[model samples]
Target: MKKPLSNAIKKIILDNIEFSTSHGFPNIVRSESFILKLMWILCLLLSSGYCAYCLTKSFQDYFSYETDTLLRFKRVSQIEFPTITICNKFATDLSRSNEVTELAKSGYIKLKSEFTDLTKFNEFFKRVDYYFKYNSIEYKDRFNFVGFDIDKMLLNCNFNFKECNSSNFKLFFSSTYGLCYQFNADKTNIRKISSPGKKAGLSLELFIGYPSKDYDLYKSYGAHLFIHNSSTIPSSEFEGISLSTGHETDVILSKTYFQKLPKPFSDCAQDSNSSEYIHSDLYRETIKLFGQYDQKSCINLCYHKYIFDECGCYYPDLNINKNLTRICDSDIGFECYSNHSASYRESKICIECIEKCPEECESIKYSLQISHANYPTPFYADFLMTYDALINNGSRNFISYSNVKESTLAVNIYFDDICYSIVEEKPSETIEQLVADIGGFLGLCIGVSILSVVEIFDSILRVILLFFSKRMN
Candidate 1:
């Protein structure tokens, strides 16, 4: 039959192999003596097998997607100033806590003793629990109405020697520390500091005032301070730095930038939109409650959602719509807050929240070095007394000149260095690197390359075409 097709194809392949540029294949095809031929054949088989093993290992390493962290230094002429948030340790103003006393007087709730000043927050809660059962008071708004006033707390503010006032600050409510005042919170026109060091940054004289002895439950004295990015919602409860009265506190900060590889290289989320990681239910319900989506805010939202679903009530401190969500009271406290504490500790929803909230592809954080000194020497206290009196409007509660040291604290916040550190993640092996590694192994083991592979494919194509042509003839 016109030379069997299979034999013709095999002969063609053999002819191409004999002249091929590939190292071991041509040596095997050209050998004449039986011993020499066997040697070349063995050599070809070993080289080919080693080459295959190297390439398989190379592919496996690349697919593993290991990453390396790089530490870099950057110097900038100007850096955006961090948001500063201050919360008085004692949340409520004793003078303005008329709501509870008024409710007690209205026969809305029974009190064991006169509802004068809240000695403990539990006393306030215990008093309110009865009234809350009968009334739907907007608890969120209540904090705004009765919480500490910024005008009373901030005695003086100076930024780069420019005068700043309560008007420069925005008010936000903190569950742990009542009303908080935040500076540089407006994102439209962010403040930037071109100079480093204490004098070039922000200076403030704060009056924490006399902490009410009645409500000594928290026992945390003075004001709570936070430094963070402007876009982030301040979580003062966990991140706050304590500022004690009678001390001048200096906070020197260094900025750090983090960048991570996305997708196959890492699990970091690259999107700026918080919705990328935030649950749909949380995004829809609590987007208004928080400014940006981050691990902290996401966790808070997730916690609120779980509490609302499981207990039919939200945390007492959280802001919620009275019409839609019930605020947890003493009655709900046992079943939801206390009894479910362990359940919350072991809940799958909480674990899932952590899984959903991944590290951002790019973010910034500040590292702080804090130092303190006894503030307002006797002479300085005397001089400030006049200014303090003027701002206090001659009220009896105006920080007394004699006790100014006990009520007043000074804060200096500034960048210690103009240069910051950058921490970035890079893939250990890129695609080009992986390819080059495979090429190196191929060349060393069997003298193969891109051209060698192409030559083999070309030979197969030639065989297929010639076989078809002969059949047609």
Candidate 2:
């Protein structure tokens, strides 16, 4: 009732004002009032137009907020996604240095670290489900596993990659006589599945090369692995990657991938100005498997016998003679391990297991590249190749996965979200990281405009009142 009365009063005032301008006091000719009224109307119109323009611009900006693609993770109750396996548990220490061990123990999982300087290493991965340890030599032949290129292994999808293949487990190399091996070092024992508590299991770690935060789902899942040890590692040099290990269990990092630590911690986490690749060796594995690192010294053929120094071999406990290059000559396919050095390297805690396998030597220099294109994604993943073993569903685990590619790769990711999407990167000299910046900015403007307070009508009313009062001579 009050609203109608108010409106009626306002209408009457408007009509009276209009009539006064056109004819009231015409004899006296109140031209000043007429001119002032006209001016007020024009000012109101201009204000309304300007306000509308500003509002539209602002709205376009709100929805267009720039989201920096950052790495993250999520968890669910069900197992899904294809092409994965979990072999071991890992500790997420998050530091980089000589402090490979000395991480906080979380349940059955122990932190593993390097016996020497840490570089390019990690102790857990998302590929295969990893227990807290590596498979024992006693149960080496328990599983039947195989690796293949994307072409043969990719069951579905339609991405066109340059090359894809199925792994040949029986033969180690492409050629039969090469490297004196029946199967590639990795696939030697890969097909059998075992219950978690029943047998020794696979060990995995993650080493990422690029930023993974560009994807939304990955950012939701926190690392399942984390460790904090205080004994073997001095607090100053805690060498934990995304995951770490302790003395009791293996801390493993994978060479298949890499990641950038978020902000403040990233700078403090670096051993030096440079960033090193992460690997899957727990502390103990580092001393032994670290021999496989593709260093300039290890690349050539070994003609001589086992000369630790000649081959550029170095371990924390062993003082190898650098003069004995003949000991590492690649031509003879020979390498030697001093029984004494091996003893010193093995700790008393694992003395029994260490002694059982005295001789540790292998002669091979090879690199692996994993690629596939079934569910056609962009060409961005072409160079991305790092594998992991991680928990798939609540009840299952996968031992080998080639990084978080199509988490939507025919496998159900459990969430009703975009399996994948990219955010714009801030401008840089390299255009690779500069996609869709303009689009993102526009979206932000749109969203902000919807909630804007300075509206066209409000501005127009103010402008009209200002001019009318000024002209009331």
lDDT of 2: 0.25
Whole-model lDDT values for every prediction: 0.73, 0.25
The candidate 2 region of ten consecutive residues with least summed lDDT is: 174-183
How well is each residue in 3-59 modelled by candidate 2, as lDDT tens digits? 664555565444434433222222123346767657655654565565556555545
lDDT of 1 by residue, 227-326 (tens): 9998777764358699998999999989999998988886665665555453455543444565554556656677766777777776654344334246
Per-candidate TM vs. native? 0.84, 0.19
Which candidate has the highest TM-score of all?
Answer: 1
For candidate 1, give the lDDT of residue 209.
Answer: 65
Q: For each of the candidates, give the backbone clash count.
A: 2, 134
RMSDs, each prediction?
4.5, 24.4
